[model samples]
Target: MERRTISVTGMSCNGCEQNVESALQNIEGVTRVEADRGGDTVEIVTEDDVADDDIEAAIENAGYDVAT
Candidate 1:
């Protein structure tokens, strides 16, 4: 599996974390997604290679910004 950690901004609560997690989990090949509000970060595990833009799009769609 492939793993990536993305620093996210604008997550203030568990609900925001869930939103980010849900967005990433909907993507194809994504096996796991961990969005931590306390840490302001997101970790994604996928079964196959995935594009960074795809992941970033998901984060943007969730109303958050990902630090590059």
Candidate 2:
């Protein structure tokens, strides 16, 4: 599994964190997703060939900003 931690912005509550988590989890290769609103970070585990752009786009679609 590939693991990465992405810094997220604009997450103010657990609901926002959930949104981020849900978005990331929807990706095909993604296996796990954990978003922390307090720390503004998201940890993701994927199978193979996970694109950073795809992950970032997912966050953006959920109304959050992701920093590389």
Candidate 3:
């Protein structure tokens, strides 16, 4: 699997972590997702190739902002 660490914003609590995780996990090609509100970061594990835009969109869709 391929791992990616992404920076994000607007996450203040654990619930926000779950939301971001759920959103990213729903994306195609993604196998695992871990989000941390403390550092505003997300770590994703994917089985297939995943686009950066797709990941960013998933985070945004979950009411968070991915750092550009």
Q: If ranked by lDDT, best first, what sequence of candidates would result?
A: 1, 2, 3
Q: Write the per-residue lDDT of candidate 3 for residues 43-66, one digit (tens) a residue.
A: 999976788989999899989998
Cα TM-score per model = 0.94, 0.94, 0.92
RMSD (CA, Å), candidate 1 to true, equals: 0.8
> What overall lDDT, based on C-alpha atoms, would model 3 receive against the true structure?
0.90
lDDT of 2 by residue, 15-66 (tens): 9988999999999999999999888899999987989889999999999887
Better structure of 1 and 3 per TM-score = 1
Report the C-alpha lDDT of model 1 over 1-68, residue by residue, as the tens digit.
Answer: 99988999999988999999999999998999999888888999987778889999999998999987
Off by over 4 Å in 2: none
Q: Where does model 3 exceed 4 Å of error?
A: none
- Cα lDDT, all candidates: 0.91, 0.91, 0.90
Residue pair clashes in candidate 3: none
